[model samples]
Target: MGATPVQAAEDGRVNRDKLRELIGRMTLEEKVGQLFVMRVYGHSATAPDQVDIDHNLEEIGVRSAAELIAKYHVGGIIYFAWAHNTRDPHQIADLSNGIQKSGLQQTTPVPLLISTDQEHGIVCRVGKPATLMPGAMALGAGGSTSDARRAAKIAGAELAAVGIRQNYAPVADVNVNPANPVIGVRSFGADPQAVAELVAAQVKGYQSGGVAATSKHFPGHGDTATDSHTGIPYIHHTREQWQELDAPPFEAAIAAGIDSIMTAHIVVPALDAAEDPATLSPPILTGILREQLGYDGVVVTDSLGMQGVRTKYGDDRVPVLALKAGVDQLLNPPDLAVAWNAVLAAVRGGELTEARLDESILRILELKARRGLFKQPYVTHKGVDRVVGTRSHLASADRIAEATTTLLVNEGGALPLSRRRQPNLLVVGADPASPSGSTGPPTTVLAKALTELGFTATALSTGTAPTAAKIDEAVAAASGKDAVIVGTYNVAAGSAQSTLVSRLAATGVPVVTVAIRNPYDVAQLSGQKATLAAYSWTDVELRAAARVIAGKAEPEGRLPVPVQRADDPTRTLYPIGYGLSY
Candidate 1:
């Protein structure tokens, strides 16, 4: 290793001399390894009980994650919901510590960047022990950047305490398409300006709390109807339209000095004539994101396991293509060993230059240095319990949830449902079947909260979509009730939920429809006497909705996206910023 005299600047930037010296000492294999971020679990694959069943280890040509770390010298490890299966904060901390120890045992001893998809709300990968807040759309509905900043700070602090230095969150995509299967509630709002402000605030909050905030799915994935996880969704907007709608938030993120940006797999024909997804298109990644937007931070690709990228480029080729397109880190590459060897081959074959590879490695090293990982790379088990899901953090979550409950419609003052009357309430659509396997707070939370407020509340859930028989059963049950509170989750997917609510409303019981997930459910169930948008099915949001119904807490949330009327798709029933209070 050649040592150059490079001093640390006044701004505490990474010393160029130290970065170059570290690069000088690394072999080509080690340098290639630094560009890949792999996923790991708590247990070792080579263990007697775990052998042959460890598919991840089998693909990577390593018997154990520790062995992979020592040999491959991967730059980072990402934890998904499956990785945190133990659910115990102490166990999670131990796992993180173990990984860091193994990284230190390597010849180069570069610290691994511990990361997770802790986007909070329904998308939280680490559940229970982590404080669950209403996600991005709810924060936008609350209409307070300060609250968004506070929520991010609390989330960032908890993640940092558990040794997770990077959070793939604060989704900057604008939810302009209501039929958008994936980014609906995950986005901040339909308006670009509002989304930009909140995204910037979240970036500031995350960095302030010692965790790198990632503004994700660059060039926007919000307007497309398809989910990128399943296929390549094309965004058919021109450059002028992108500037007016999608590009503003990302521009704001760069200005906020976001630590990282994750690329979407969607194709933008206007940006690149080649039919390649943004992940493999230099015109989109290097040209638009780097040159046009002037983003100097690390650019990471979304999981290569996703079909969007997998269908076009197999696991063996996606990593090299992403590197050629200027992505600094390859997140969740399909096969670590194959991707690593492929990149090594590319450099040797002159497909990729060593100088180009060094640029990404330097950026990755700078990120690790900026996070102060070299000083303290491990976290204590006690720290996890102290910071994760503390009372104060939960309180912030509750406040945001309460503030985000938007009452979109209230016919004949049906809201503030007279708790004094002790009305018999039939609660429908509380626990719908989730296709994505997301677990929310208990369905009984809303019924229990309403019951405590002097109203007799009965809860019923007929999965994601109810059959005709189920609808009849619900209507029969609601016959004698004084009021009906029907909770709808993603009614746009099918007519079953809307049909049930419309039928129940026809029974002449003051029907109060609450949008449990998608706010656009209001447009479908227009016959309901009252409509509310809870945005998420989390406990805090459910309880907040119940309180608003009982006149306990005033709803302060506004619609973050427009609701297209069911009768006419061209017409919007409720515009953005539409909300009512008690």
Candidate 2:
């Protein structure tokens, strides 16, 4: 295997010799072509049958992706997982090899960069068996830098197996607001310092394992209650406040040598709200990042299709605005023609001078050279087997699944439910019949794990108000049983989903409320009953709850983010990295 990209660039320096040698050989158009990153819908060149393939080709303007890369001199491809695309991992590896072998149009022979959103551990790739590690919050709950490293390694190794070099991961946003719509479980925690440490570890793990890592949402997207994927999230912190809260993680990650930084589509009125979102803001991207933090590596934009940019800037002009603002690459351009025309027009119109374009291309080429793409042998199908997912990786994933579980609140020594004593129990789900269907996986896992323990468990789903009949049955079942488990799966945002908690609180039974998804929900019912947080929707979290509740194991996991009240207290709901173990 080749050296990790970090080591290749190690001397604490960028190699100017090799960089100049490569840049001297590229044509103006060819060099310009390498600046735009296009999204590929399918796994391989032969994927999705001929009809689907032909349509994608006609629409994108290139049949085989190899042909596209060669014809347009496109520099990179970002992969995604939609049901229509081939899901086979090996096939994806083959496709990547084809693009690499398409060769360079210029003398430098720069290999096309392959990137993907394997943020939650290779969500897109087919070769690697998936690791059900809890999301970012779980890692924050686990409060182990080692776990952060492990998650990054899991993501890095899987992506590298399929020939993907860049990973958009280790979301650096600090989840200060529990109600943050999109970045909930994706962020580290509310504290900037904790977020910095965890995110840095993740970046180190990925880079050390030979995959480049990107720390995202530049100024920070963790405090907003809105999702930028849907609309522009306006952050209200002043410059001093922003520096204190949102800027630390990016600074820490860059100091640790993370390869890429992704810009978010957030509006900061104090900064550049009138002109552009952060992704296309020269003041933020160029002035703040390039100047203040001293980030010299590639700067990538978030998906151009996001409503934040598409709604305001318009698809026809985002590429130019982003380029002039110091973005290194346009990621996931919705309309390639629009991006191409916009960029070309910028150059012709002198809005984006040739010198500026060359500067961005130079950094990209430097990254490619550092990755040893120009020197290493082109990957072939023969080596495809050697690189895809392996048995050892799957085992590592299973272990991580077990380590990231959190038990936020417990009472009645109700966890590690005793099968010998409370043999018969009523499982109150988010709804009256099935909890997993209504609220997600935490409560479902509790229900399933209890069943595995040889206890007689019946799952009842309930909404804001448990049906009169279902509540009566649950109350009747609780009368004879030793305990009643209510699965309340509420998120930080949205409605409080705990009708079972409310109903069971009214009853005299020893009620245990398992917060399957949000920590805030557990906080809401603090005075009523025993509450615990699984922090995610994965199976491992449920099993962890099973072990703790069965008295077979102790609840060792803590809260990564603070849980607060409806009135919003000065302190968070649960303090950062707070956990209780018996």
Candidate 3:
């Protein structure tokens, strides 16, 4: 006998008859609308009406997000930092409910797949009150798939409580290149197998917590030096090389039944000879991803507004090309109406067949159904408040942070600063302003935590990077201190901060360097008496780092990425899985 055919129900369960009925009822415009995911600002009353044209198409400006839903019928909505204007859980829930309610008011009334880039750790788009968990690298450093699963579950539950059905997270990229500016700490680790194991575990946890997990920047964006948000990154690797290095995690994601897979905006000439990005390349998206890898889930493009896609294809052509290249959904199109109309025109002109459009729409609809969004599209305010940033979740985050604090170097045994002696410590480099736009843990919090641990701690910031004069001033201030702890955020990018630490280490005083963002900072300040990797500057992680420094807690994390020595870039000082305890 043949295999039984599955069905989809109106509530988005497996009821094939209902799915066929709904798809048959959708018009061409509605089908085209299902291919685009647009962005919305805060819950402000003012409608965005500023219009401009690029490449012979008028940009779509709206008075409100409701207008976009009612008029264009977008398939989904992605929230950015702007949309999360307030940190209040109830207010954020109300915003999500409002967006979903507006979609219901539309003629077709298909529920929107509300999504956000809540990849906790360094890349949290949604601001405060959301439990700040460690990033992917931190999970890998912790060396436990169970921690990855637990952290993802907590994050997924918090997001789901706010009516978010999808999280564009658990980046599958393997950060093999230390110079990789964009994906360093975001990736789980440098080893493909390790990343695969952790990625699969996170996928299961996210799905178990009721949010659809999206394995992102598919194939991989780990080995490049460029940021896709700014420009196109080229990856030079043969097909076999890519499969061995970058394909494992994505394969694991598919095996774990991830609901969505996002396309990278980078160019891989080995995959496709064309200069076009993966987001617009048929060979990369359709041929390799669909045919070779056998990813049958909804394939989404990275933000269409990114320079990687926008610079090559204008606003008018991006959506059409993306749809033609087998993308199921266009994320953050430059102009929603223009992109929607262009797709409609493509189908009408036979440039894209109605059957082709339906293929993606069906996948998207299936995902919505699988997520049970059709059943409960809105979340209650009380539910959001109760689950989001709950005490238990925060405690989990704290434990994860502490578990991921790595002691990379402690030659002089500067750590576990003798509590009985009560060292007079001067803490520096806790910049409140994160260069990545993330609100990191404040310097005051670290100082307060240390003070509570019976140390006389003083906190100071040299902004992002301190100058020579500022370094000299800091050294003078540290003249009488028993120990100096310098917090470095993204030291890989800031040479001045590294120099300041080096100068402090040269002063012959005990200097403990804490890398607050990337673990690679240890390579620059290897001369320090002690070096620690926190991986994130969030409140929980900073407090955990302080606790480890004071011997209140032990460092348990291993290094996730290789660190090149400061004196020799060719030599790796600390390889993956290298860490120490007091």
Candidate 4:
């Protein structure tokens, strides 16, 4: 007896037809299951935190992966391998397979969607480790959309090889505010048009390479000074502000056929005065995202447990409210049962309609089917060792690191420090921590490269009080030497290096300040002979900076942001598009 087409369809992975058929057959409960995306940790119990009596306290750890899927029939899973948990990429792969297997055990043959936040090649879950590409700002510094696309391709290929079908990345927020914490490194740059183009390329790169890309923090998180994860942050800008800066990249991404849009928990008072928070606000998600911007793809939320929502809505009810607000999937809710029950309660109480649940479920199923989850024989037993941190990928990462380094300032031929009988070099900056946490390279990777070029180098560690006297001593040490390089690490969050930069630049020995964080610091060091902004402390930037200083490489890096005059507090520390070549 030959098999019927329906039977063959049933055996194969989910496609559009299969998804439609499954949706038609699903009960209300099944439909609701597809709307919930939960965080999953593998079999290990003692993870994320010291085996707290309550395991799911931290964002990284969760209740057993099996329990969540088996009980709730979750639509998707977001993977994050925090430090405490088993960091093995293969272990994560095994866990991913385990999730699918658990999903298949359900009465309905729905495949679970697996995702991760592999925004940069450094942030990936699978494949041989590649170089941590410079954050968006570095690509902006490189002054090319192609660099952004190349970065996305590397990140996508690495993630997809490990079965991460969805990547919640390419943060589309503009980095306009220097005081803005948590977003400086993540955003591409401050320029709206440049950010839009680069983000669109990133989306294209991820999707084309098989990993679904998500343009994040819609409306925008750019202008705000607060961190959404910490509290209820609001973008005080008006509708005009949003239309010009915050809304551009999102529009570009949607136009580029982005697979998903993740809503930030930010509130834009200009858009919706009442119920301003975007995550649970209907006006923002439905009215603006769906109706105005015309984004028809899946809408996912930032972690529900973040204080932006949780502190405001409490842990129990936020998930259900998010669904009512039109978010198709929730990211990392507090409790799966609590969230699921809340959804059920909402459905029973008429707060959430079955029709609404079906809409989200159908979309999820469509996405899964689109991913070939229903038709294919999913083999989760991928030996992760072969794919994770492969040599070829690592080499590419090195190249990206090298190419993305931008030289912000060089004056009076002060750079390209002498290689033979080299001038005395003083290095100060990032902890020389290797991947193994061993003191790898001091003074950023670029400083290490300078050492290799034969510069006699001295590293002055930036202590709590980075004083002018210590800098003067270093300058005195190199009294007859050709140059003094002060590598400052004050850009990224958790920095205490700004004092050192100011102190060192004060000593007049042809001082050059290398800023690997914000380019604004260039204005702070106008008294110095030269200032450089590499935007990040990644190894690649380190090497590029070394080459540029040693005169081995030309200073081709243009300022991605404005360079403020060092003395101008009223003016931007650095105006956008300010860079120097000597």
Candidate 5:
């Protein structure tokens, strides 16, 4: 009913005159609340008796999403399935509409920025009914910016259709570390230039889709080994290397007019010796991102609940310090009231001026308006089915997934398992853990795809660390099958996962290994008859992998990152851009 965010002020940009006047009318508490993007636990926005509403009550002392908004004048709400905030497409749309309804009833009536970590592949928060895209590394493996743009566009449109106007996606990290615990396959690739190209494309794609895109973990979360959710990792890259390795993607995203840039919680001594992590570092956030890269877009912090960002700072102190460091948003602090009150107190105490808070509020208000939230914030529930998970999006996802199904090793031409002969296949491996905690989607998807293609495919989920009995069962299953397909997840050379692949390879059956989660798993799985990377263990990715094995889809993807030898990091086993096709 209204213009997309990208076109709201197509030529003139946001109405600063109106936004500033509205800011002048707001109380300091309201302005401070606008900077926070809090998380509430519930499937229904206004339902107090809904599932997981206790978490909302305990966290924010609010029983409903509507209460969280009306009580705090909250500016944004991020949904997570784990928090019981999302389910099917219609439920998510209804929840979003209810949240917007509460926000629109505010004194000044600003639209809430409803968002989620819809990073598709492995990090997907919403599933099934929402169309999933082949994630960043998959797009990188395919090495097509055009496809990347289309995938994000489709995903963005789907999210927007469900009233989710903001997506925390298009991970710009150039994952260089094989052992990176957090941002491995989530990144575009190991190369800065390639990652930059895809990031720019996705930014434009999401913008074109009516949802505001947030390019994230700014200054790069690619090379670090630590998971910021657990602990703070320090990057050792020099200032020049940061510019070369980490800066290009963000630079490109900014150039593409990305609506937001989320900050990383990691410490980079190169960027600022003064600031422990990039999230609260003025030198990094203000000096580098804002001044150096010239990004005028919203600077949102990585979750304040993360151990990395909260380690050196207090719960209340994190928000204040982050604001002082030029962050426009403080995302999901563990306690909402503490963060809000601390910020409110800082302004009242003259530690943080109301004028300072206005800077962030104005930008946030502009974002809300640009997204056409001012013109139309609600969506009809009927429209959710029409756009959320359409057939065309699924086809595009499959196409992108097929493009990323890379053949890393095909010794003796073990792949293209004979469909005419009707090979009985055994799909057995650990169903990798997703960020959302669900496992076995990829393993099951692979089996289903193989079976649909006329193969007798049986799937067995060997738990992450397979027990002796589980491995024996898998080995026994492989012994009877015509061929064995093992899905290895982030395997180290002599690790139990590598041992599983080795045991499967010795089954006297033609063994095909799929690097289901990380592409680096292939380096340790050298003994397998064939090896390929699906990049991520999502439905589409593994489905594409199955099609490739069954000769239905060609392995068109190349290695996005180099796989170094297990024993020596110096030796390259498979260089970047290395992928075999028969």
Candidate 6:
């Protein structure tokens, strides 16, 4: 039987009766606004008609964020660094408070759900002085649910302190393809059960830290070769394989009572023969996620502007179809007027009934109440920095990063080098700058770390493809050096880093190549003196790698995913749990 009003209120902590009456009183335009989670341009809630980096008056057709809320009655706002919404902790809190103030001042006064993609490791939108934990795959390598939970709790707590209530995090993709460009290091691991356990733990951890947790890219975006942001990738998993590989993490999420699930924009031809993205397919989102998975919580579509959703449907039809497919929140449509009016028109044209929207609106309102936003949504600006990047939080992040140091190959006690023996070290190789615009490459960070540890380390920033001159320069630099370390990022068997490593190994200076991004490069650099997988090039990870080199810390991480054979992608060079200890 369905829950009674009192039972429902107890279960979801929402005043269902009040929300229902409010919905009955809502105008058609206001009801339509409750369905969208839009993006606005600025750092301030209300601003003058001026132009700046983030405040483009021409683009938004409004002065500030408050104007967007008043003009369109958007239910939520998502922040991006490019939008200049997160300049710092205090600013973010002020902006969030301002947005909530305007949202509550409306005629129908609904509090906005403020959100960001604070996925922590490579995908983090909120940068330092916020504590940045080692991301998902690093936790997979650490092989501890407690560690994963603790890291997530810290990250979620910092976001909450700043009034960001929703974080699109704990990516449950279960990456199995070594060649998958987008989700390689973002996923937990290739093992479905392992990923499931970590995903469930992270869900509880994030919620306990005071925000809603979203397990995203539903129905398994793990094996796709194409990124959904640029092109729609098809997953050819048979029904049986999908059951084995793709279904477990989401099932675990639902079992954990996750607050929301975001739909992937890919198509699984086996699940539904139609070529429509899962964002618009009834069979996939409703038949599978709603009925089979038994998830009645808020269902959000991935960004509508992504190429994955734009392939089949026009801009007008995308939002309406997604709503028809049972998605509660339409996220980030490029054209606000077109998508918003299309959804409004669909309800008026009788293609969509108001009852369908009420189902979603009630769930959204219930979520806000469950999060305790209705009572106290504002955050003091001064309190933001006290909780964001505290010493304990930074220490916890360091512990997680140090634990993810996986030593792939250590020949004859090659690692744990003595500072006295390896005093003069040459650090060179591809140090790709962070896509998120972090400080210099891993090479520079490692050199700086070693110097801090009382080692005279010389850094040579060789591009990934070392030119003839750079190669010769690195080789000359390696001559007579006590030891040499090279950082490689996602190098294939015959790739440029592979060629560079072969040349450096000939120097007989104990060359160690650390896999900074993709650990699959292990198969390519197997002949080095030693290889370590730090999983990411973030400063914390590199500093941990440096400590291990200086005999200060132990390498505790193992390969989360199997290392694919360089020549043949079907086989593995090393198993998932393979890592050497010094």
TM-score of 6: 0.95
After superposing candidate 1 on the true structure, give the runs of residues whose Cα lies further than 4 Å from its correct spot: 1-13, 43-53, 58-63, 433-442
CA error at residue 216 for candidate 3, angstroms? 1.2
Put down candidate 5 lDDT per residue, 1-582, tens digits, no spaces: 323222233343677887887788777778988999988888888784544677777778988989998899989999888887777788888888888888767776677999889887788888876788888889999999999999989988888888888889889988988889999988989999999999999999998988889998888998888999999988999999988898999999999999999999999998898757899999999999988888887889999999999889899899999999999988999998899999999999988999998999888888887887877788877788788778988888888888999998888888888887788999888776653423345667789889999999999998668878888889988877889888888887677877887787777878898888888887776568899899878778888998999999899999989989877889999999999998
Candidate 3 residue spans exceeding 4 A from truth: 1-12, 44-60, 84-86, 430-442, 492-494
Go through the candidates in order and give each one's C-alpha lDDT: 0.82, 0.70, 0.81, 0.67, 0.86, 0.85
Q: Give model 3's TM-score versus the native structure.
A: 0.93
What lDDT tens digits, residue by residue, belong to model 6 across residues 1-582?
111122224444677888788778778888898888877766778752245424445555566788888888888999888777887888888888889888878887778889888776678778778888887888899999998899888888889898888888879898999889789989999999999999999998898888899998888899988999999999999989999999999999999989989999999998888868989989889999999999999988899999999989899999999999889999989888889999999999999999999999998888777776776778885677678989999999888888888998989989977786548989998877573435567788899999898788999988888887898899999988888899998887678778788888887788888888888888887468889998888888888899988889999998889987777777778999999887
Give me the overall lDDT of model 2.
Answer: 0.70
Candidate number achieving the greatest TM-score relative to the actual structure:
5
- Model 1, CA-based lDDT: 0.82
Residue 241 shift from truth in candidate 5, angstroms: 0.7
Worst 10 residues of 5 by lDDT: 1-10
Model number with the top lDDT: 5
Candidate 3 residue lDDT tens string, 1-582? 111122344443566566666777788888888888877665421333233111112344555567667778888888776443244567667767777777666666677888889887777766557777888988888888998999999888888887788899889999998888888888999999999999999999999888999998876899898999999999998899999999999999999999999999999999999868999999988898899989899999989988888888778899999888889989988777678888888888889999998889889988887887766677887787788877888889888888899998888577878988888988887584542233444566677789988999988776566878888888887888888888887675448887888778777778898888888887766468998898877677788999999998899999888888777889888988899988
**Candidate 6 clash pair list:** none
Model 6 per-residue lDDT at 287 = 93
CA displacement after TM-score superposition, residue 5 of candidate 3 (Å): 23
Prediction 5 global C-alpha lDDT = 0.86
Better of 5 and 6 by lDDT: 5
Task: Estimate the overall C-alpha local distance difference test score of candidate 3.
Answer: 0.81
Residue 201's C-alpha lDDT in candidate 2?
94
Worst 10 residues of 1 by lDDT: 1-10
**Could you tell me how far off, in angstroms, the CA of residue 221 lies in candidate 6 after the best superposition?**
0.5
Error of 1 at 458 (Å): 2.8
Tens digit of per-residue lDDT, candidate 2, span 1-582? 232222224343567665665566677667677898777555564334566567567667765566567666778987765522325556667767666766443244567888877665212233223444556776777778887797678667656656777888879998888778888777877889988999899999988766789999897998898888899889988888899999999999998888889999998877775657898788999899999889889999999888887778778788888888889988888778778777887788888887788899888877776555655524544455554445665455545555555666666555655676557777775632322111243445567788787777766665544566766666666676666787665533334444445666667667877666667776556334466676654555566666666766656677777777655666566676677666
Which runs of model 5 end up more than 4 angstroms from their true locations?
A: 1-13, 48-50, 434-440
lDDT of 4 by residue, 331-420 (tens): 877676677778888898998888787778767766665555555424343534454456765565555555555556566666656576
- Supply the global lDDT for candidate 6: 0.85
